[model samples]
Target: MNTTNLIATIALLACATGVFSHEKSPHHAPKAAPMKEQKEWGIAGDVKDVRRTIAIRMTDDMRFTPSAITVHEGETVRLRAQNKGKVLHEIVIGTQAELAQHAEMMKKFPAMEHDEPYMAHVRAGGQGDVVWHFNRPGSFDFACLIPGHYQAGMTGTITVLPRKP
Candidate 1:
């Protein structure tokens, strides 16, 4: 074969190999997200470190059962959220400002993709939980940022009290 033809054939085989490798390789699995504390929201806590567990229910009515909760500063909590509704829902914890910003973004991009440690995307009738350490003394918020969910009033509060000396 001529020099130019040889180079073209080699490039073709390289492209073919790149495309076929995925079909043969066991290493094509999706990458796992690294475990990291979301300190902007709060430190990530372990299940064993949970000082308390609170049950929260989400409904099609766009509300959370026991929509308000309190915890002492530096306390670790396991928030168990159950979706009782007939639609997909998610629980995202953040500051009220953050929630509002995210909610607005969701409204604009209803199918936006997200993966966050402080967020739990649950299917209908499914349940999930998050272990978070509220090391800061302040009020935070949790909401369902599924487009119209937040506007329909799917939000709640977390009050972190001052630590007792």
Candidate 2:
């Protein structure tokens, strides 16, 4: 083969064997197995395991209607967020300290993008859901960590009651 053709063939072979591939390339990423992270409140739950769903409303006034929710231990609930205002809103579930820390971080980085199973971002007139299993019985906090939103009292509480004997 000519010199140019030989070089092209070698390049193709190198690429096929990943000799010139970037180790951090997205295509080379390992398959995403389901996350098994167990937070203080609970772990991520599958949709099929959802035993109940609670509808929450978000308005421009930075409030979540029926701000307090109750659930039993070992129950998987789908927390559905409905945004009725003319802006974006989100629900992030975590311990009180975690929520406060995250909200402060968001104030510094307004455009930060964090996608966790415990968070659901909903656009105006749209809806989102977070399926979570409450295995730990405790009172957790949920909030909208969108810059000034959380400071405006855009928060709620989730109470996990102990299961009946």
Candidate 3:
């Protein structure tokens, strides 16, 4: 092949091998802040510190089972999330405003990629989990900020009550 054709062939092969692939899944999120960042919502939890386990099911109907969860302040809950639908799903933990903003960004950038300690992404019939520390007392949100998923109502609440004296 000519010099130009040879270079084009090499570039094509590289692309075919995913050498330049940057596409990402909707579950992709920004790097989670450090555990000691003192978030208004809470922090990532340690598996060993989990006080209990809870299940959150993602359905194709754009819903999450047990739409609300309650936890005590300073508690860590291990969440077992399952995608019972026929599509991809995820559970992203954040405040209502945060989730809403993330969802809007996801809608604009469908292929955004992110992985954090407080997010779980699963395929159809798949399962995932996250350990979260409810260190503060307030209401937070957990939603599937996967493109249209959050807009379709795949959101839940986490109510953290103050710890007893």
Specify the highest-TM-score model's number.
Answer: 2
- How should the candidates be ordered by TM-score, best one leading? 2, 1, 3
lDDT of 3 by residue, 5-32 (tens): 4664576567656523534444545755
lDDT of each: 0.84, 0.88, 0.84
Clashes within 3 Å, all models in order: 0, 0, 3
lDDT of 2 by residue, 12-124 (tens): 56765673466656677665766779999999999999979999999999999979999999999999999999999999999888888778767755776556899998989
Q: For model 1, what is the C-alpha lDDT against the true structure?
A: 0.84
Kindly list the per-residue Cα lDDT of model 1 for residues 1-165, writing each as its tens digit.
667546655875686687588778877877676587656558777778887899999999999997999999888898998999999998989988888877866775576555666778888999988778888888889999998899999999989898999
Candidate 3 TM-score to native: 0.77
User: Between which residue pairs do clashes occur in model 3?
Assistant: 28-113, 28-114, 29-114
- For model 2, the run of ten residues with the poorest summed lDDT: 15-24
Q: On a 0 to 1 TM-score scale, where does candidate 2 land against the true structure? A: 0.81
Q: Which candidate number has the best lDDT?
A: 2
Question: Ten-residue segment with the worst summed lDDT in candidate 1?
Answer: 108-117
